[model samples]
Target: MKTLIFKTASGYLLPLLVLFSVFILLRGHYLPGGGFVGGLIASIAFVIHSFANGLEETKHLIKMHPGFLMPVGLLLAILAGASPLFIGETFMTGLWFENPVPVIGMVGSALFFDLGVYLVVIGVTLTIIFTISETL
Candidate 1:
């Protein structure tokens, strides 16, 4: 596993996967894709790395426990939902913000919600995968 190919290919592949995952996540709020898809994509990337390396190495690479991810994700989702309350709107009500942001047009509260879902999905998926992989 100390070969150059493993190191080099993983080095290149990880960033590319992250970029693609983010692209899917951002576009998903509006298009067919969304948080679930994006999170799965990101999880796959890490899973690939785990297969290439070892579980302990992958854990070290991630620098965080899988159990910790779920809570953070849940918090994000809750925050996204609660955001509307600050503006005198009902919870989970979609609020639009007409901002001319490049690449990501019309950033809105829905996007925040999507992002929250994205984090939650990634966290849950990774937690499951890693936990099961430990048994295998």
Candidate 2:
């Protein structure tokens, strides 16, 4: 497959899409968006990149195999949800801590879950785009 490099339009649009995805992900906890929606949006960005560039270029952009990351993300998410169980609490219970320092206090399993979702979304998004593009 021929490798296509990023052009000016893609360069500008990619960052915008990624920023939007992050915004959605962050606001998801309270608003209509969430990790899933954010992931989808981010995946769309990659898809756009794949369309603008070629499959080989996209492959080159990925430093590691996306499949490997998926399990890690899943584990993090599971561990997050299961953390409360270890402490004799119910599943998916919220845990909060007071910080001696700034507003950054040790948060509960929810943040971990979000992190897991973030990684999973990124991994899956990359994998889907790479796979489909390669087949073309």
Candidate 3:
């Protein structure tokens, strides 16, 4: 069928797109492409996959319902924000530590916060998209 051909042809593209989304997510703290953009990019990829295959297959590919992404991402963000409180500093303090590994160099609570945001975006986007797609 037409769907089978389309899915097979485009199946290889999903991984590449997801990887690029991750790259954007990681570099976002320093530059323009943060969670919002990265999450959007990832959602787009999933959307493509969903269209090519179907809602159920896309869900199976991720092995999780879209609803799960929001809470976990929220938890990560909250924990990152609360980290400073545990260290006797102000809430959501930007605490930076020099990593022994270069490239990554300095790590901070801000990075974790950013990561949490990234997850939230992905979760919420997927939740909405999948819900809509499933309904139709």
Instruction: Name the weakest run of 10 consecutive residues (lDDT summed) in model 1.
Output: 1-10
Better of 1 and 2 by TM-score: 1
Kindly list the per-residue Cα lDDT of model 1 for residues 11-121, writing each as its tens digit. 778779988989998998679887778888888888878877778888898898866767776787788888889989999888777675888888887777777777888
Clash number for candidate 1: 1
Model 3, global lDDT: 0.81
lDDT of 2 by residue, 1-136 (tens): 2233445566677789988988777666556876777777877776776677765665567667877778898999899888889889998897655553243235556667876797798888788767776776
RMSD of each: 2.2, 3.6, 2.1
TM-score of each: 0.85, 0.79, 0.87
Clashing residue pairs for model 1? 28-33
The regions of model 1 sitting more than 4 angstroms off are 1-8
lDDT of 3 at 57: 84
Worst-scoring 10-residue span by lDDT in model 2: 99-108
For lDDT, candidate 2 versus 3, the one ahead is: 3
Q: At residue 81, what lDDT does model 2 achieve?
A: 88
lDDT of 3 by residue, 21-136 (tens): 88887777778887778888888888888888888888889998767888888898899999889879998888777663466545677678878888888888888988887787
Model 2, stretches more than 4 Å misplaced? 1-6, 99-107
